[model samples]
Each structure stands twice: as C-alpha cells, then as structure tokens.
Target: MPAMSRSTEAIVRIDSAAKTVFAYLDDHRHLGAHMSASSWMMLGSKMDYEFDAGEARLVGSKFGFHGKILGIAMAAEQVVAIRTSPRLKVWETIGAPNLWVIGRYRMGFEIVPETRWSRLRVFIEYDLPKAAPARWLGLIFANAYARWCTGRMAKDAARYFETAGGQAVPSIG
Candidate 1:
C-alpha cells in the first residue's frame, strides 16, 4: 500500500560550517565508509562493496552491498543522483528485489547554515507494496530504522566536520 507514515524532515545542526559539510558528504570515501559501516551492522548485510573506489564525482554512480535478510541471501545496488552540495544529495536503489517488495528507497539530504553551524536535513521516501502485512512491517521498521539512521548520520556529520577526516560514527542504541 501507500506509505503509512514518512519522516521526511529530520534535521540536525553540526558544529562545522556548510562548506565542510559539503566537502565531507561529497567525498565518496567519507560518505561510503560512514554509511556502509552503519548499514552493514543494522541491516545484517554481509559485505558492503564500493565499485567507485574513490572517484564518485557525479551522480548515477553504482555500488553494491551483500547481506542476508531473515536468512535469505540479498544484495543491494545503489545509484547516486541529484548532487546538491552541502545542501542536497539523493540516491536510489538499483539492486535488491526484496527491497523492491516494499518500495523504492530514496535518500535526500539538505544543509542550512546558521551563524556558526549548519542544520543538516535528511529525507527518506519509500513506496510500499499495496499489501497489509508489508505495509504494517514497513511502518514498524520505518520509524525505528529512520531514527537509528538519522542519529548515526548526524553523529557522523559532526565528527566529519570536527576531525576533517573520516571516522567511524557510533550507532545510537
């Protein structure tokens, strides 16, 4: 069915300015490491692979991640898109049929600069199958997963700004 609920407007302000946020997010290795590590554990994905190496300059770049869901083997393909520096970034899934069962996974990010810091805005939109059980499970997991992912991204953004280097962002339990 249609999405039961969507938390598309989560915001977090990081200590770094807008430029730093832009640089960090645009840096493929930085973004990939932070997200890959977090997603691997949370999704129980076996291997997170980056086909881009370090040259992820434009959108449409593709990457794959291997994992299992409920003991069923799975792999996910992600395609980069809509690169808006320090403001907006979007990615769509190109792999994983099981994920398609629920809906398409889309990620959007925006940053607003304040006096000394920047507010990071993230939006996640997924179209769900028009089925009761799937919709129910989507709702249940959506909220919990969004919260988990949001906190992790914010923490990682902060560290990325402060350190000016890539570091593992701790998951917030």
Candidate 2:
C-alpha cells in the first residue's frame, strides 16, 4: 500500500559481529557523539538526569530540539517506537514557519556470524503539509537532507562498529 505520506528511504550494509549494531544504538549518549553536524543535537530528553535503560522500548516517547533552517527558527520532535536488535525505528514531526513535516525513519541491521559482515537498510517517510508552498519546499530539499543524513550515519557507523571491536565491512554504495 502507498505510504499515504511523503517519504525518503535509504539503506547501507555493514560488516559487523553479533549485537554490535544493537549495542551501538543502545548507547544513546555515545550515538550523538558519533553524529557530526546533527542539527537536532538534543535528540532525547534527560540530558540533566540519569538515562532510563528501558527508554529504548518506550513507545510514544518524545523529545524536541530548537534549530534554524536557512536561518529561520524551526522545532522538531521524534518518537521512539522500535529499538530492538536488527531494527531501530522512530518517527519525527517537525514544524517550521508555515510548514509541518512528518518523518518515519528506520534502520535494519543483519549480522553475519562468522564473516562478521552485516547488511543494513535505512528508510524514511517524510510527510509534508498538504499546501502548495509547503509541498513545494519539501520536494526541493527534504530528500537531500535524508540522503545526507543516511550517508553520514552509514560512514560513522562503519567507523564506530569497526573501532569499537566489530569487524570492518567494506562500505557498500
């Protein structure tokens, strides 16, 4: 069935050992550090308190960040839905001056036991306001952002998994 919303999808295969990818995301604190140039730096709530280990499974869990796009103030919130091994999924709602966009993002990792090579898939669904200007702007730049974020994450994940003791898989295009 059609998504009934705008979307962006990307995938990257990683070579790593069992639980490596899951462990990487399980460390929310360290994950942000690995992200370079993330506009939404304050991804989750509780920077001031202790990390809730169960947060990984909290559906409807939300967090927001204030940022500027093209120098204009914008706000975004993401909700956690799935965060188990082999699959990490979340959804985001973002609002700007006259635009509101919804994004459903997911990443999948498949670990190869002996070779330690893993396959990864990343997908994003971007739903924009049903207005002309909003649709226009989104069509112009949303995919670019998705592509960049996906590529960057893939590269960073590669470096992270390898250096953190997982096997290094040749990056796939």
Candidate 3:
C-alpha cells in the first residue's frame, strides 16, 4: 500500500442489510474464496491459507496464502490495517511478495446502507510484482486478475446471503 499505483473496484447491491453484509464480509476468512480454490482465473492453481491468532478477525491480525504456481513457490503475508465494525475492513500485504501478476496490495470492502439492502464495494490497490518475469506478466494480467478477484468476492457474498436464507453466517477456522 505504500506505493500502490493501480487499483480495481467492483460494487454490487446485495439483497441483505448493511449490517448483514458487513458482518458476513468482515469475517475475511470467507473473503478471497476464489483464490483458495482452483479456477480459470487462477489457471487451475489453488493456494492454501494460514490465519494466525483469532483467525485475523481484527486489526493487526495476519493471514496468508502460499502455494506453488507452475512449479515455482509463491506466497504473501497480509495484515489487517483497519476494521470498522459493520462497515469497512481493509488489509494490506506485508514485506515482499513472491507471486505473479499483482503483487503487494491494499485490499478492502465497504458496505453502504440502503432502505432494504446494502451496496458493497470490494477493491484492491496494488503494485505489479517486482520480479522481472512476474512484472512483465503483470502488465498483461494484473488488471484482469484484480477485476476477477473483486468481482468474485462480490458475487460470492451475494450468493452466500441468497442461499443462507437469513440463517446465521458460520465461522470458518
């Protein structure tokens, strides 16, 4: 986040309350669902997660994703920078990231109240990877990855609430 020069954002109107949506997404264990699973966006690569102490449920907490991509190891550590209850949550990558495409980033989600539902905005401000190969590839795929990552988060939340049917959101450890 120190010098993130590019960003991508996606907004979706969810059929759930501001509080409801915030509560759901605030538990970021459920966020980044797309990256934890193999998909076209990830080119069939799946990353494993590790959340430390209280599962990164509050500011100053840490979490990460580590996995091999095309026979090379890649990883990143992220720390929650801000968490305003039932409204906004932001996290940023720490140290150098050994990954492809988008590298270090500040990612966040915000919920806005409406009469009956909520408007959710998911965004990422990022810098391309510093490694030459990854930076070169990033110039081609960074925006696409950002768009897909944000869009997927929004879509995932929407689907979650719809199928949840007002039941309580579950905890993931």
Number of the top TM-score candidate: 3
Q: Which candidate wins on lDDT?
A: 3
Report the poorest 10 consecutive residues by lDDT, candidate 1.
Answer: 164-173
TM-score to true structure, per model: 0.69, 0.62, 0.94
lDDT of 1: 0.61
How are the candidates ranked when ordered by lDDT, highest leading? 3, 1, 2
Question: After aligning candidate 3 to the native by TM-score, how far in Å is the CA of 102 from where it should be?
Answer: 1.2
Write candidate 1's Cα lDDT for 18-133 as tens digits. 76677676654555554466355355443455667534546877765565556665565777778877577777666443541344567667888889878887667666644666
- Once fitted onto the true fold, the runs of candidate 1 whose alpha carbons sit more than 4 angstroms away are 1-5, 32-35, 38-47, 53-55, 95-97, 100-102, 129-136, 162-173
lDDT of each: 0.61, 0.47, 0.86
Q: Write the per-residue lDDT of candidate 2 for residues 32-137, one digit (tens) a residue.
A: 3423243452232212212234443355555444444445444444455555554554534433323323233333233333464665554555555467665675
Q: Identify the runs in model 3 with alpha carbons over 4 angstroms from their true place.
A: none
Error of 2 at 88 (Å): 4.0
Between the candidate structures 2 and 3, which one is better when assessed by TM-score? 3
